[model samples]
Target: MTSLPPQEFTSVARAEAPLDENRGFACHVLIIGGGASGTLMALHLLNASPDMRVTVIEKSALLGCGIAYSTTDPGHLLNTRVHNMSAYPDRPEHFRDWLRQSGMAPGATDESFVGRQIYGRYLNDLIARERDLPEVSRLRCVKDECLRLEETPKAVIAHLGDGTCIRGDRAILATGHAVPVQSHAVLTSGWDFTPPADPGQPVVIIGTGLSMIDHLITLLRNGHRGTITCVSRRGLLPQVHTETKPLAISRGHVPLGAPVSAILHWMRGLAADAERQGGTWRDAVDGIRAHVSAIWRAWPEAERRRFLRHAASFWEVHRHRVPPDSARWLQEARDRGQLRILRGRFEEATMGEDGLIAVRIRTSGGERVLPAGRAVDCRGIRRDPAKDSAPVIQDLLARGQSRLDPLKLGIDTNEWAQVLLADGRPSRRLFAIGPCARGAAWEITAIPDIRVQCAELARHLHAIEAQDPVGVSRG
Candidate 1:
C-alpha cells in the first residue's frame, strides 16, 4: 500500500460552535459511529481539507475504542501483525513507533502481536491530535446515538436519541457489527460478561471462530476447570500464524469472473505449489488479499451464494488466524482434556430441570446428546442487514433510503461507497463504510483494508466538495 502524505494545515480557523442553527455550522461530512473506521475517515478528511467541517457521532464518550478494543483483557491479542495494523498506509511504522514512544511496548517489533488495549489508546491519541489540529476545520465529537436518518434533496439530517437533529452535506454510516442472536438455551458470548460459575461442569460453545477462542481464554484465565465443547458444522479452528515468505502473485494474477469451482481449483494448485517449494500455503492465501474485493465484485450473485453456502467457513478459518501464544494455549487445553472440538451441527437444545442445557448434535456417525452446564452461541453476528436490529439501520430500510444487498450479507453499496436505495439507485447524500459496506467489499474489516478505504473515500468526498464549493446540491 502507498503511504499518504502528511497533513498540511492552512491559516483558516473556524469558531467552535454548537450544531444547532444558531451557530450556523452545517457539517460537511457526518460520520455515524466513531470507531476505528469512522475515526480514520475523519482524520483523512481533515488532513485533506483545512476548511471542511466534520462531525462524528458515537454512542460512547470515547473517540476510538470500539468493541474490538474495549476489552481490557491482556489475553485478547491482535490477530494481525503490528506493522500491517497501522492506521496510515503511507506511514507503515506509525503504530509500531507509537507503541515504542508511548512506553507501552518499548521494544515492540513489526511482527509483534500487541495487546488490543495498547492499540485502542493509540487510536484515541491519534483521533485527539487530528481533532485538535491547529488552524484547521472544526472536528466535533458527539457523545450520542444516532437514531434515524432523513435524506433531503440538499442535505442529510440525522436524528439523535437526545431529540436533536443535525444536518450534513453528506452522511456515512460506519455502525460496525450488530448484536448477535441467541437461542433460549444458549448465551451470547460478548466481552461484557463472564462465563457461568461452575468449575467442574461442562459447557458447549457453538462455532469455533475468534469469538469462541476469546471465550475459552476468558474461562481458562478465570480458573474454570470445566469441559469446553466447541461445535460447528466444520469445527475448523483458525490456523496459527507463522512466518511467511511473500508469494510472487499480484492483483491481476488470478483470473476474475470465473466460476467459484474454478477459483477454488486455481487457489488449491497455488497452495500445493507453494507447499512443494517448502513454503507455507498461507503465503499463497495472503498473496491475494488485495484482490478479494475485485474478485467478489465480479462474481455472479449465484456464484457468491454458492461460495457462502459451501466454502465460507473454510475461507474464514484460514483467512483469520490467531497469534502463536494463543495457539499454544489452545493446544495445551486440548491436551489436558479440558477442551474438545467437534465437527457437527448443533440441533435442538433443551433446558433441563437442574438448569443445565441438553444439546443434541448430529455428527457423521450418529446423533449425540451433550449435557452442558452452560451453552454460549459463539456464531458471531448475523451478517444480513435485513435481519439487523440496529435502530438507525432499521429506520433507513423502513424509510426506503437503503436496501440490503441480494446476498443479504450487508447493505447495498457501489464501488465508491455510495449507499443504494430500494429503487436500485445510489443515494446522493448518503454513503457507507466499514462492515456496513461488506456486501460490496468482502475483505474490508481489517485495518490494512480499511486504511486504504478511508484514504480513497476522503479523496472521493474532496472531489465532490471541489465540484460544489458552496455546499449545495452535491448530487
Candidate 2:
C-alpha cells in the first residue's frame, strides 16, 4: 500500500544528422531495455559522475516492471528474502529500510517475502531519485524498440522501430530474458493462464519449477478444486529457504577451476559438512554464490557444457530456492491428493473427443496418457535469445553485430561484459549485462551480481569519457 515517487521523464530526440561515420553523437550512454538491469546501470553511471547523460529505450509500455516483477498477482512473491533483496549491495539493508519507511511493512523482518510488484515500485522510485538530481545529469526514457545498431568509431546509432534513430557514444544491451518458450501441449509460458470453464476440471503443468508454483498458487486461489499434475524430466522442485544464518565457504574447500563432476562432489561434501554442523544445505549453497562466476569462468569449454548438461538442474533446484510458505503450500496440496508430481518427458499432445487435452509422456517405465482440460508450461526462462522472436536480436545476429556464445545460451561477451562481434572482436562501443551477458558471467542475472557489473561498467565508461571527452563528439 506504499506510494512511490512520481517519475519525471523527458523525451529523447532522434538524431537529425545523416547516418555517416563523420557525424558526431550527442548522447553519452545508450541503454537498450529499461528493465531492472538497464535502470541500475543508468543509476550507477549518473551517480559515478554527474556529467554523463543516458537514454533508455524499451519496447514495453511500462518501465521498471520487467517480466520478473510485472505480475499483479499477490501470490507471486519474491523468491529471495527481503534483507537480501536490496538493489545496491553496498547498502545491504536498503530494501528492508525502504519497506519500513514507506509504511509498506511497519516492522519488516529479514524473512519477509514481499510481493514482487513492491520491488518493481522500489526500482521505479530509485530511478526517479537518480533522475531528479541537479545539472550535469540527464536521464531520458524512450518507449520504443531498438531494431538495429550501426556502430562506428565515433558513435553507435540505434535504429528504433518507429523510424526514429538515436546516436550515443556507447551502447549497453541490457535486454533481459527472452519470451518464455512454449512446450509440447502448452502454447505459452509464464503466469498467464485462463481457468477452465469447469472449476473441477483437471490441469497439467509441464515442468515443476518456480513458474509451476506460481500457476498452482493462482489456480488454487481462484477456487480450483481439481487434480493438478506437474510433469518434468526430474520432477525437481526448488528447496525452501529456512531461518538460518548463512555461513561462508571454509578456506580451500570449494574447488575452483575444476570439472563439473569435481565441483558437484565438492558441493555435496560442503553441504554434508554444513548439515553436520547444525547448518542447512542452503547455507552451503549461499556460500558458493560468490565463487560461481569464477568457477564457471575457470571451467574449460567441455567442462562448461558438462555442467550445463549434467549438473544444471540439480544446482538450480538447490541454489534458487522458493519461499517457505510456497513450499508448505505445495506439500499440503500433494498431501491432500490435489497435486501430483511425475518425472517424465513430453512426447506428444492431442485433442480428445471429450474436449480434453490428451498428453503422451515418456516416463521411466513406459509411455502414459494424461488428460487435462488445460495445460501450462513452467519450464523456466528461455536461455537462448537467438531462439526468440525479438527483431532487434535477430538483426544483431544477422548483421554480425553480435554472436551467440559457444554454448548458445546467450550472446557472446568477454569477461568485462563487452559484446563480441561475430569475428571474435570485442566492440568498444557495445556492452551487455544481465541475462544476455550470461555467456560471459554465468551468474550475472541476479541483483547481487548485476549491481557489481553496473558499478564496474560505469567506472570503465567514466574513465573512457575522461580520457578523451571529444573522442565521441556530438556535432
* Per-model lDDT: 0.79, 0.78
Which portions of model 1 show Cα errors greater than 4 Å? Answer: 1-16, 21-27, 133-137, 469-475
State the weakest 10-residue window (summed lDDT) of model 2: 8-17
lDDT of 1 at 409: 73
What's every prediction's RMSD, in angstroms? 5.3, 4.0
lDDT computed for candidate 2: 0.78
What are the runs in model 2 whose C-alpha is more than 4 Å off? 1-27, 132-137, 181-186, 250-253, 468-475
Specify the highest-TM-score model's number. 1
TM-scores for all predictions: 0.92, 0.91
| Candidate 2: clashing pairs of residues | none
Name every residue pair that clashes in candidate 1: 3-90
Tens digit per residue, CA lDDT, model 2, 349-381:
778998888878999999999998887767777
* lDDT by residue for model 1 (294-345), tens: 8899898999999889987888888889999888878999999999999999
Model 1 poorest ten-residue lDDT run: 3-12
